[model samples]
Target: MAEAEAGREGGESTLTVLVALGANAAIGVLKLIAGLLTGSAAMLAEAAHSAADTATEGLLLTALRRSSRAADRRHPFGYGKERFFWALIAAVSIFVSGAVFAIYEGIRTIVGEEAEQTAVLVAYVVLAISFVLEGISWTQAVRQLRREAAADELSPMEWLRRTDDPTVKTVFFEDSAALIGLLLAFAGVGLHQLTGSALYDGLASLLIGVLLTGVAYVLGRTNKGLLIGRQADPRLVRALRDDLGARPEVDAVVDLLTMMLGTDQVLLCARLDFDDALGAADLERTCVAIDADLRERFPDLAEIFLEPVPRSDPTMRERVLSRYGESTGLGRPTP
Candidate 1:
């Protein structure tokens, strides 16, 4: 987080997110007041959820700050993955504090609370205002995420799946859920007010909890995978192979393997088949070419392992033949 205080800077990304976080905090307090005054269980649950989100946003910003740190002897790859780790923690907190708490409160009301409806107009008014504020924050987050994903050449949903930074992705999804949930809350509160039925509000809260829990689970799995290291995407592997094969020194890509060390970092162990006549000198040049191409395509790679084998080597040839097959000439014989 100290690095964020240093010279590293992005255009209003920190400021905007921080402001939005503050807004959620303020809105949460207001909703709490409104809930207590009207005895609306749904409003109280919404207040808790919003407050939890506010805390999460603050955590995300802090992670972003930490992730901007420069590489050093301690962490040679820099602190980029720190964001993912911290965000995973935040996601778990969302489930425990926001979703679980809301669910418990909702169940209690469903079983025991009478359908008390006092000053329906006031509840509607407060909810409408909260909706606008939450909507604005959600829209802003989405717009920013959309632009970032587009720059990476990915669809919004696909971008979420591929994104290395969990802080940004988590905030985007959470805000989206919150936006939809607010609408649900409005509908539930309206119905409860109209019909004197506590079921509507409690049910809405339950659904909102479920939505948060699901998002939390997804975010947790994704971040956990990243933290433990995952394989580079298959499509990217194919692209790397093709690029290496295009080099004159590399006769063929015999075997290719990649492991992710961090978000954009990769460790590749590749076996390239070289011509039998090529000596160690030529083979080394091929290795250099592969390294160059990999760096050109993905500069963040942490390590590369290139093993050069003779094209005529039986092991290499057999493997290639198994995949691509030999001419055989069995279909047509020379007379």
Candidate 2:
């Protein structure tokens, strides 16, 4: 079941990335041609932005593939976090290729180093087409995001931050930035034509650069935090405790720890204090039953360890009792 879910998510990410890649690649080519023919600085900036987006999407696609590898002896936790590494690289590339270059071009045009286009029809046409294509890609990303968010019962912003899947998040932000960049390009070109000055065009380029820079920072930060060993969501933790505590043999839950191993996988370690009435043989059987039940409940839990400890130790028992309160729905005495 976990494998099926991962496959579905993989398919979704692949489709989203491919659509964005095709649109950006085509838009980049058109913008480059239009920029060259019309000598419009804003058009050139838009061309560079589209080219960078195409490259970033390719990088994200690679991340999705390489990170999906099954666990081996060398990587017991699997290659899930490789998605974060590649995403970080994409963010850095955007800053260098998209933000820095656009800003430079804007500054140069402002100083009259590049000629402004007096005939801007080609720029306008290219911008309009790019807007429509980018909008389509952005729409697809948002739809996928909304579906995932709904499943988790979270707002879009909350889901984006806590989601183990990084591909959709990256694409959503990139497409959003692309749309903004297109608008900036349009404004820059329009102002240059209206006021008979290239300064507005240059300023527009700077604004796009600022926008890309902000997007890159956010993407990088999100990936970095995930790569550094983020824990599984608290909701999952609470659910695990509630389900285990409901068992008649479970007296109390001592400690529970969980880590996200991959987009669709988690590792859980739990220390459980069973009722004192059970003998050694019954304890062993109970442990096995608990393990089976937990795995059944959470297919995404790739690994689980449940340690049965005697409740004779007062210090440890008291600590466990204090930690799990009534609010967790785990404090009720088992029937």
Clashes of each: 0, 0
lDDT of 1 at 223: 87
Q: What is candidate 1's lDDT per residue for 71-171, written digit by digit as tens?
A: 79998767767877888888887898789877876787789858677766767787788878877777777776787678678888887788775766777
For model 1, name the residue pairs that clash.
none
Residue-wise C-alpha lDDT for candidate 2, range 30-95, written one tens digit per residue: 999998887777778888888888889999999998898988999988888888888889988888
- In candidate 1, position 82 carries an lDDT of 80
How far out, in Å, is residue 297 in model 2?
1.0
In model 2, where is the ten-residue run with the lowest total lDDT?
Answer: 326-335
Which residue pairs in candidate 2 have backbone atoms (N, alpha carbon, C) closer than 3 angstroms, thus clashing?
Answer: none
Worst 10 residues of 1 by lDDT: 326-335
Best by TM-score: 2
TM-score to true structure, per model: 0.82, 0.89
lDDT (CA) per prediction = 0.73, 0.84
